[model samples]
Target: MSPQTCTEGFAYDRRARQCIDVDECRTLPDACRGDMRCVNQNGGYLCIPRTYSDTSCILGYTLAEDGTCNDIDECETNSHHCNPTQVCINTAGGYTCSCTEGYWLIGGQCQDIDECRYGYCQQLCANVPGSYSCSCNPGFILNPDSRTCLDVNECEDEPCSHRCFNTYGSFMCNCDEGFELAADGTSCIDLDECSFSEFLCQHRCVNAPGSFSCICPPGYYVYEDGRSCEDINECDTGNNTCTTAQVCFNFQGGYTCLDPLQCHSPYIEVSDNQCMCSAENPACRDKPFTILYRHMDLSSGRSVPADIFQMQATTRYPGAFYIFQIKSGNEGREFYMRQTSNVSATLILARPIKGPREVVLDLEMVTVNNVINFRGSSIIRLTIFVSEHPF
Candidate 1:
């Protein structure tokens, strides 16, 4: 026959033949609240942190969806231990525990042991009337015999964040060359070594994830020391676009292409920067007497519709109309000339160009003489060097 009432943790079944353990974990869901996983015992339920459960997933990180070591949102999936009454707070790798530390249980209860009063702990000691136990320091665990303490080797777990070194009782965290260990000693952040010194880069310093880069201006290059800038001699390095008819002159931060003071195609050198067509040759009567060469540098992926180069009439005359056009070498139609004024024209890039490449264009400017029946024209060979990288 069944008793009238069962014990505190035992519930009488329908038949009432025998008493069964009550599942307090299910019936009293609030029994284990706040990051406490409820484990059903024979007579009661024990609350434990999910991070310290028997199936702790920290060793392999979390059970990611792609079967990789990625963080799994327990709160989002309703897999957290927080009960309905408490708010679920998610941590980096796991959740904090609301449950108290569990005790080591033996087969049966016993009276106070006399040896415990003497104390046998490597770190702390506590003595009470009917109970006493030996405990180790924070970085140690009690041995099976309950009298010995063993040091905890934390480095074996992982990179405390990036790298770890286990010491006698605790561990130290170290980061790589380009990173620095955070204050928490379990995480790492990028180190901006460039900020330490302005001399680190001659012109500009670009900070990156794990490193930095020093950049120089267009007419210069980074020195071997990776900190200073040196002028690049475009004339000697053949970096200039000057044709055989022109000469390249290098300067501090730029280079210029100048006329060689020699005439070509029925033209004669007249002055320092001018030439004259032979009046005797009918074929040369309409040909241009002056030719010029120019070069420009641009970074890759430049925004289109940007003005690249401008040409202005150095010598203006009255009753003259100026017209500018791209004669040849603009096969891709990547550029067009916009006349800003009667005496000035601007070369506009029609589309963005990806480098490293060179674009050569033959531009012509004709001046119609309305007062006199004479028309003169000039051609400019322009070379645009697009850099492989954007500064």
Candidate 2:
């Protein structure tokens, strides 16, 4: 054969006169499976199984041209019988099925796992298809870690009027000492101390923001007890408008003005020696009169041992006999007159005055033997003041 004129599968052979078959099976040993027998053909070779290990492969695997079993990735090839929630893993010669994160394998099937039963979340846990998520209850927020829950700070926005307190899963509004929580629970209101207790103030009640103050009415002031009220003396404080001639009398809640008593012109004595008036004078025809007055203040139910009034009268002539007689006014009802001598006399009150009153006394003096043989009279007015308290 020509060197360049050889058939497709046979090389030219100089000793051969015609074309002949080439023993490619013996020359190309790696043309088929490494462990199988190679059969020669007209132009190619065929590999035949020599042993069961050389021709067989385990499940999910196939025999390669090198006579070695190669693992089949059923997960990547989508050939595994695992469920959608399960994962397929490849082995040396086989594949295994397993459940995902939030699922469990049971009876060759994947089932949803209850992660909440295992205390997976601090507050609340919810299961998804293949995973679980953590959540929080009201008034709380989920932490960034996704497993723990944190309390929300409701006081950050100043929802309460006074104070705010935080608790587990919730928040509370608080008020100061003198305040109370409102109906909405987020605000604060002032407490009415006067409306709840009457003993807080003795006279008047004044309510303030966080407290209350006690007040006394007009003409009164707070007492030493700090609660009760006592009457004020307007006279002592110069608060009274009474005149100089008027007396200012203080009462429980107020003061009263007392007017001074005045006598008429005819009842008053203008001259000191009224008994010495001439007979020719028209005043002498009538009885000459002298007036005396005095004022006394005595506590109710108390008696005075001293005399209230004393008088001494002398005539122009000596050795004259005189007689004194109590005429009108009081009629000696509240007083008694004693004649120490013919010219002197003293008057004393019977008892303390029970009430305020004015006493009028009229005394007549008659001279038995005198140059003028005249008669004289004197008028005495006594004012008694009865006070309930010491002045």
Best-fitting candidate, scored by lDDT: 1
Name the TM-score of candidate 2: 0.50
Report the C-alpha lDDT of model 1 over 1-391, residue by residue, as the tens digit: 2233555665655452234566777799488879988766545667889777745544314665654555556677777765443344444444321211121112222223344545555566665544456788887988887777899998888857688888888999988888998888889899997898987886889998779999997878999999777778899999889898887866555566766666675777666555667657897776775667666777677888899899888888889989999988888888999999989999999888887777889889998897897688887878777765543
Candidate 2, overall lDDT? 0.64
Native-to-model Cα distance after best TM-score fit, residue 382 in candidate 1, in Å: 2.9
Query: What's the true lDDT of residue 180 in model 1?
Result: 91
Clashing pairs in 1: none
What is the TM-score (0 to 1) of candidate 1? 0.45
Best by TM-score: 2
Q: Which 10 successive residues of model 1 have the least lDDT summed?
A: 97-106
**Colliding pairs, model 2:** none
Each candidate structure's TM-score, on Cα atoms with residue i matched to residue i, is 0.45, 0.50
Error of 1 at 158 (Å): 16
